[model samples]
Each structure stands twice: as C-alpha cells, then as structure tokens.
Target: MYAPQDDTTLLVDALADEPLAPGARVLDVCTGTGALALEAARKGGRVTAVDVSWRAVCTARLNARLAGLPVRIVRGNLFAPVAGQSFDLILTNPPYVPAPGAHRMPRGAARAWDAGQDGRLVLDRICREAPALLRPGGVLLMVHSALSGADPTLRLLRAAGLTASVTERRWVAFGPVLREREGWLRERGLLSADDEKEELVVIRAERPV
Candidate 1:
C-alpha cells in the first residue's frame, strides 16, 4: 500500500522533463494508485499501469476513471501483463527496503517497501528484464534507494546493451520503514549511526534506435 512519497515526486519531476510525444505509449510497472500513470496520460501519452496487488489495481482504475483518463490498469506481476508489447517509456518505483531476511520479508501492508536483505529483490529483476520491454529509442525511468545498490542497477542496464545513467538524485530523511530498520541496516553496514538520510536515484536507460 505505497502512496505518493518523495521518491514518487522525484520520479514525476524527472518525467515532467521528458519529451513525451503525443500518443507515445507508456507503461507504469508496480503502479500504486496510478499516480505516475495518470501523470503520463495527462501529458498525452497512452498509458497502461500494472500492479501485483488487486487493491492497487482497483485503486488505480478508480483514480484513472475519476480523473477522466484512459489508463488501462492490469493486475499482474511486472511486465507479465504487458508481454509481447513494447512501450516508448517505462516507469516504476518498486519495493527497495532492506529487510532482515528473505523469509522475514513483509507480505501484507509492507510489501510495498520490504525487499529482501540486500533490498534488491525487485530492483534487480527490473534491471535484468525491463530493457527488453522498451522499443527502439524508448527509455526506462526507474527510481530506487541508493542503499539498494544504484550503481549495480546502472551496470546491469548497461550490460543489457542500453545506455544507462543516473539522471537525478535526492537525499531524503529515512522514512518510517527505513527508520524502523535503521538498526539492522547499521548492522549490515548499509547505514551508519550518523546517517539519518538515504539517497534516491532516478536511473534512465534508453534503447538506442
């Protein structure tokens, strides 16, 4: 149940600067509440949003309808719902919290933030596979915590034959989830006693035409 937060705003800001041509296809993976999807639709992009949570799908659908936007909301894992199709842009803000253990990962409400130990559970897969979903000249704009290995994500994207770079970064104070796990994170050397903030990075990877 992730709602709009600083990371969301950062991604939206980055998106606002993109040159989205009219009717450009946009896919929002793990869209929670359709925030990014709606923003893209408002910019004249044909947008589709996918989520693993039934509740999130419902919320996004309702939000789109209420906003009078034609956003297709699908209930499925990342990329599954949009298989066999390509998009001009892909946007996502998946879970990246560094939980204690794999088995200790959150299920219900915390699924939005509790990624396994290294916090790369979902981020790694997105980097590994999302490049294939982009059409030639298309780009992916994904946002996640630097604590979750932002450089690794950039490397992964580059290895996939895409031009990748960190377009933006912001230092935000530890949110509730991060604050709660500060101790464990410190133990893992992912955080420090004086570290009260975490850096969020927006990674942009483009498939060359």
Candidate 2:
C-alpha cells in the first residue's frame, strides 16, 4: 500500500521549480497527508487542505505539525468545507481508480483510491467546481490517470471555462487485474488481459484572467 504522502516528493519538486506568488492563497483538495499544502506553505503561500476522510485530515494535521508548516487541514468532502472560498492556486491528486464491479474497497484503501467505474467521479466533479473556486487568473493543478487520456479531461475543463493542458506524465505498472475483473474489462473493451500497466498524467488548468 502506498503511504499517504506517497507523491509528496514529486509534487514538491514540481512546485519548487514553479513557485507561487508570495502571499498567494492556495488550497489542496484531497490533501492526503498535507504534503502539497504544507509544501505550499513552506514556499510562502497561505494554504488550506481538505479531505473526505477524517483520518486523513488528522494525519494531515499531524504531518503539517511535524513538518513545521502552518497549513489549515479541514475534514470535508471535496469543496464542501470551503464553500464560497476562492484561492489563487488549487492542487489535487484525487482517487482515480476505475472499479466497476467491486462492491466495496479493500479496507484502508478507500481514503486514497476508488474513483468511479470510469475513474472520473472525483475528477469530473473537481473540474466542474474548480472554476468557481479559483480567482480569475488562478491555476488548478491535478494529477490523475492517463488511462482515460487527456482529451476528455481537457474538454471538460474548457467546458468549465478554463484553459487546460497536460503538464507532466509518468508510466507506471498498475499491477495485474483480478481474473473476473479482467474478463469484465475485456468484455467492455476497457482493457486487455495482456495489458500490464498504465500511465499517470498530471494536468494543470487555469481560470481566465
């Protein structure tokens, strides 16, 4: 299982290379260990982190404290906790797994994984709501699977009135599919049994100035 802070290093490295304006307001949705939010704070942004899982919020709070970063960690689903709050920068690495037939997630995995059947539940919602929560000229950075590809995501972002683009990509082994799930996926033509892995796509979109 991946740790809550699994992608902290990569996210931090990216942000460090592209620093936000000083005193910028930032939000990290699905802030699984507060890594992005804390890192943003460290870089001089006023940061707020939100997550659906209570445990994740607690862990994120502890992580911020341990890292000596002052980030506000809130427990709530998606943008609900920060309704009417807009920010200069928003970042998220949401749950993006396409599990069709699974009745329930493996115990501990629910907090970090499980997108919808097409792996777009959280992603779609975020895209739809992001424009409203971003100040004009603000940016929204999101990391998700390339399995669904970038076209649809870009289309969604545009429809939401934001300009979007692929910022980074990395290919990684997603592991074997369960036998029954594999058969199901093949029937739907979503995947082949021989397919061994997938790619992760990081995208960044910006609200118009």
Candidate 3:
C-alpha cells in the first residue's frame, strides 16, 4: 500500500473546499491508507474506498475501523467494485511516477507509483472512466506531479465532457523516488539540472447537471 505523501496532502486540501453534504456518496479510488475516504466520512459523506492491492484494502479497512469512520472498503481495480454506481464525489491519487517498463500489473512496492513510461497509464484510465462513475453535478478531484503533464490531465478531463482545471499547485523538493530516477527523468526531458522542485497539482472537474 502506498503511504500518504505530498500528493495526498494536495488532494486532501482540495477536498476541504468541496461542499459535501450529509450522506453524500463519495468514492476514493486507489485509496491509500484510506486517508481521503476517512476525511470524506468525517465531513458527512457516505464514503467507499477501493484499491487494487490487497494490502491496501486491508490497511484501509483497518484504518477506517480504527478511526471509527464508516467506510466501505473494498479490494478491486478502479471502478470495478462500484459498477453501475454513481458518486457525488470521486477522489484519486494514482501512480504517477515515470517508471521503467510498461508493466501494467505492478507488484510489491512498485504498485505504489510505478506508472509506465510517461506516467499516465493509470491516469489515462481514470480520465476515460471517471465521467461514467460520477452522478450529474458530481465532482472529481485528482492529484499528481507536474512531471506527469498536468495539461494532459486537464485536456483528458475536458475531452470527457467535464469542466476541468488545475485547482491547486505546490512545488515540493524531490522525494526519494524522484531523486533516485533523476538521471532517467533528465534523459526524457522531464527534469532539468536547475529543477530543484517538482510541482504537485490538484485537478478538479465537475460534471454538468
């Protein structure tokens, strides 16, 4: 299971501005440690959290139980567990690191952030699938690093017929993952020598009523 990180914080901060009413249906995809789901529950939402990793599912369920928050934690690929169900809010912090191979079914710790090649493998799926999961007037909030191309994310969301924009951005120093792959990132022109920080972004999209 991916531990909560800077990207998680950005998404959580964005959620604070969202107006979730009592019993609002909220889905947290790729939920790590159930942080987003728990927060939504605390804010009066009927929350469900899903992750492909069994460890993630177990950890999230345990966290929700310890927090005494009523979250429906499930183990499944994104959107699979909630088929035909729509939500008022959808939150995700999927894998976005530019990893080595095109390994779709990532294993071990790589499951946390081993997005293949350009780092949009999981993100693209989310974009293509999220609109169908949202109720009319529902909101989707997602977070990732600028290296993953925030513009592409906005474009994808817009193409999917949602009003999307980057709602929040923060420049954070390179974490261990980025630092370890610095040379490779430079080869791909995703980073530069003077680039001391990576921009974390929270993208918000709303489905039309």
Candidate 4:
C-alpha cells in the first residue's frame, strides 16, 4: 500500500481550509491508510472512506478504531459503495504517477500509484465522477502530480459546473518509483534528466449552491 506522503499532507492541509459544517458528511475516495478520513472525523464530520483494496479497507478500519474515531470503511472502486449518497465534502489522493509501456491500469500494490502514461487514467475519472457525488454547494479536494496535467482537472471540474481552482502546491523530491522510472519519463519528454523534483497540487472544486 502507498503510505501517506506529501500528496496526502497537501490534501489534508487543504481540507482544513474547507468550511465543513458540523456533522458534515465526508467521503474519502481511494483512501489508503484512511488518514484523511480520520482527520475529517476528528473535525466532527461524519466520514466514510473507500478503497479498491480489501487490505486498505481493513487497515483503515483498524486505524480508525485505534484512533478512537468513527470512520465507515468500505472496499470498492470509487463511488460504487456510496451510490445514491451525497456528501458535503469529498477528498482524494489518487494514483497519478505515469508508468512505462502500454499504461495498462495497474492492480495489486502497484495500483497505489502506477497510473497509465500521462497519469490521467484515474485522475480524469475522478474529476468526471466526483462532482456528482457532492451535495449542492459541496466541495471536492483532490491532490495530484503536475505531470498529470492539473489544467485538465480544473477544466473538467469547471465544465462539470463547479467553481474550481488550485489551492495549494508543493515541490517534493522524486520518490523511489519515480527515481526508477526517471529514464523512461525523460525519454517520453515528460521530465528532464536533471529534474529531481515534482510539484504536487491540491485542486479544490465547489458545486453551486
């Protein structure tokens, strides 16, 4: 499982800026360690966290119990388990690293990151679907790598009728996976040979009231 990292921190920090009404319903898609969900619960929000990995769900459940927080944990692809439900806020830190070769969607542990080439495989889907999961005047906060095209995210969210913008950014050094794929990234002209860091961003979108 991908442990919490800079992208996670960026989203958590952005969540703090959101005006979550007391007992606001919150959803955390692709929740890994349930870190964001736990935080929302701590903030007095009713939180639900879902992941494709059963291990992730179990881990998140355990984490919530250990933390003495009430986080509903489910194992399913994004939005499936929460069908017909609306939340005041939605948060995600999905896989956004571009992979080599045919860019087939990843499974297992690799599913935590290995997004297909251009890194929009999951990010694009989230942008298109997440807005529907929000209650009117609700907010969605997503974190992704700059290589995955932040502009497309904003464009998609806005087209979906949400007021969207980048709220936070941070430059973080390449992690192990990125270091291993550095050569292929350069070959694809996505990165330069000397580039050792990547900028992660938090895109926040709000539905019209």
lDDT for model 4, please: 0.91
Model 3 residue 189 CA deviation in Å: 0.6
lDDT computed for candidate 2: 0.78
lDDT for each residue of candidate 1 in 6-114, tens digit (9 for 90 to 100): 9999999999999999999999998999999999999999999998889899999999999999999999988888889999999999998889868874787777788
Misplaced by over 4 Å in model 1 are: none
- Candidate 4 per-residue lDDT, tens place, 1-209, comes to 67898889888898887878889999999999999999999899999999999989988999999999989999998889999999999999998999976436587898889889889888988998999989999999999999998999999999999999998999999988888998899999888777789989999999999
Error of 3 at 193 (Å): 1.5
Candidate 3 vs candidate 4: the lDDT winner is 3
Off by over 4 Å in 3: 103-105
The worst-scoring run of ten residues by lDDT in candidate 4 lies at: 100-109
**Residue pairs in candidate 4 whose N, alpha carbon or C atoms collide under 3 angstroms:** none
> Which 10 residues in a row give candidate 1 its minimum summed lDDT?
101-110
Task: Give the Cα error of residue 36 in candidate 4, in Å.
Answer: 0.4
The root-mean-square deviation over C-alpha atoms between each candidate and the true structure, in angstroms, is: 1.0, 2.9, 1.1, 1.0
Ranking by lDDT: 1, 3, 4, 2
Question: How close to the true structure is residue 100 of candidate 4, measured as C-alpha lDDT?
Answer: 76
lDDT of 3 by residue, 92-151 (tens): 999999986675567787878889889998999999999999999999999998899999
Please, what is the TM-score per model?
Answer: 0.97, 0.87, 0.97, 0.97
lDDT by residue for model 2 over 55-79, one digit each (tens)? Answer: 8889999988888888999998899
